[model samples]
Target: MPIATIILAAGASTRLGGQPKQLLTHNGKTLIRQIADAALSLQSGPVIAILGSNYEQIQPELADLPLQVVLNPNWPEGMASSLKFGLKALIDEPVDAFLVVLTDQPYVTTDLLQELITTQQQTGRGIVACRYGEAGHLGVPALFDIRYGSEFMQLSGDIGARKLIKQYAGDCAEIPFPLAAIDLDTWQDVEAWSKRQGAGFEDQGTQPKS
Candidate 1:
């Protein structure tokens, strides 16, 4: 099955004092590039990126990568807006299913994405989401069959793929990914994560984006 991918990188990073998380360095490459590479690593379909906020600066970081870039002018509206645009871009493509990804998740691996695809194919479910802790918040790095494309288009405001995951829970399959719970949303988050990995990020400044 041909699986397409959308990497959501349009957030303004308000929580990080205006620094674009997508440009943050990890494993020698920008976060955006890392996630984009992971998506394309699947080699199953086209990878599209939704860019907003500091797109000019962030674009260069991904200039050498192979993926479609779509600008979300309504990015201020929130995550759902970017998702809607990305889904619209893929509506005409030839794909069996599409995966929605986030750029700030440094731990999201190509392996996890492949698992989502594998589970979807094996279970024949339209949606395959990562199952985390007790809150049971199903989220991206998720794969959605083309059949549910319309539901994605209906999303609005700050909502994201999670909304649809819950709306159609009966048809979804879960993959345990506690690592998905670790996301870089704030300076403290980065600090804590960096310490956990002992990545020598202690001197990287405390201003979140710095």
Candidate 2:
């Protein structure tokens, strides 16, 4: 089945003192680009990057990648806006599923995503989500059957894709992804991540930390 991947890179990164988390880098690659590359690595289906907040700054990062771009003018409305906006763009397609991923999770790998799809297939479930970290947080990077399109549009302000994962708990499948918890949200987060990677970084703005 053809599955479309949506990279949720629209948030303003207000938590990082206005730093655009999508622009943050790891191992020399911008976070947004790295996530886009992971989705593309699957070659499973179309890849769409949702941009908002810092659309101008983040859009160019994916200019060289083969994927679709949809800008959510109401990104300030919250994650639901970007999530719904992306789904609307693909609503006309005959995609079997939609894979939603956030840009800040640097450790999201192709295998982690692939297992979500694989688990869904094997379990015959409508939703496949990542159960991450020690708490086994169930959330996106998630895959949802297209049958849930109307419910996705029903998602309102501030509520994210995870809401549906919880609302439809009966049909959900899970895969362990401990690294999903590692996301860049603050200068301290960046510092900690960089130290873990054994790398040095510049203060956040537009440049990738080296």
lDDT of each: 0.86, 0.86
* Per-residue lDDT over 102-207 for candidate 1, one digit per residue giving the tens place of the 0 to 100 score: 9888889899899999998899999999987578688887999988888878878999898898999999998989888888888888788888988843212324
Cα-based RMSD of candidate 1 = 2.1
Model 2 lowest lDDT segment of ten = 201-210
**Can you write out model 2's per-residue Cα lDDT over 119-141, one digit (the tens) per residue?**
98899999999888777779989
Candidate 1, superposed: residue stretches over 4 Å from native: 201-210
Where model 2 places Cα greater than 4 Å from the true spot, the runs are 202-210
TM-score of each model, paired residue for residue: 0.94, 0.94
